[model samples]
Target: MRLEEIVIDNLRKLRRLISVRRMDDAEEAACKIVKYIFEDAPVLGLDLDGTIDEAPEFFRLLSRIWPGRVVIITCRLDEDKARADADKFGVFYDELVTVRKLEDKAEAIEQTGVTVYVDDQDECLMDIPMDVTVLKIRNEGNFTDGKWLYSGRTGKQIC
Candidate 1:
């Protein structure tokens, strides 16, 4: 089925659970919906520096929960330092890629076939194809005007 249809069905199920006042079941169903959405993604892309570095624990949890391959795509020059930091932060990833420029991030995502990408930099988030689900990590330092599919911080769905 289409992604939209699947999401709608899941929402309906969640609504039914909530209507019945089964708070626990509703919460479980909500978690399942999120898991299903991420699991359906073939690959998940994450930005290392500002995004993951700002919130290592959150990203670590996400990396562990995601059922698909996680790729850390960053524009940092020092690959060794990035690797060490990732290890120290306990963030899991299938691969770590370093791009020469922030604009190169879009190309990397396309090349890696990332269905969902999370980044704090607007430069990296822009130019990605519409087919990819772009999520913005809430970063007050960086100004991003682009509409995001979800909030990386709270996992809240956005337009």
Candidate 2:
């Protein structure tokens, strides 16, 4: 991790150690951490099941349109299976990162150096670093409301 990230992380740990009474401090620490994580290029972090295969039209359009900017991030244990499925479905991406935990996706997104992330899971998007723009795509399985859902049609607009 970078120096700023380490300092921000220490602040968060300190906030936690202090008490739940200092919620504002925790929030501030989180915001500082987020502020430090934003990258230069408009890289994109994309989810697998619902964000891609479940929404065929969006995936088809994205693969043709922004093939180079995409980095597929999934909480799939079997990397091989996920890659095979992506290949079978013709999903386009510059790279793929698989994680064991759903929440850990934030770390993968951070690692991808993406400024934007498109996903179906609200849980996954919740604690992602602040600077990243989250485009929560609509999927039948994960949709509760339109809180984080993207208003625009294309991936370019999303980025």
User: lDDT value for candidate 2?
Assistant: 0.72
Q: How much does candidate 2 score in TM-score?
A: 0.61
- Candidate 1's TM-score: 0.64
Query: What's each prediction's clash count?
Result: 0, 0
Best by TM-score: 1
* lDDT, model 1, position 28: 55
> Against the true structure, what is each candidate's TM-score?
0.64, 0.61
Candidate 1 — which residues are off by over 4 angstroms?
1-40, 143-159
lDDT of each: 0.80, 0.72
- Relative to the unseen true structure, what is the C-alpha lDDT of residue 17 in candidate 2, on a scale of 0 to 100? 47
Clashing pairs in 1: none
**Global CA lDDT computed for model 1:** 0.80
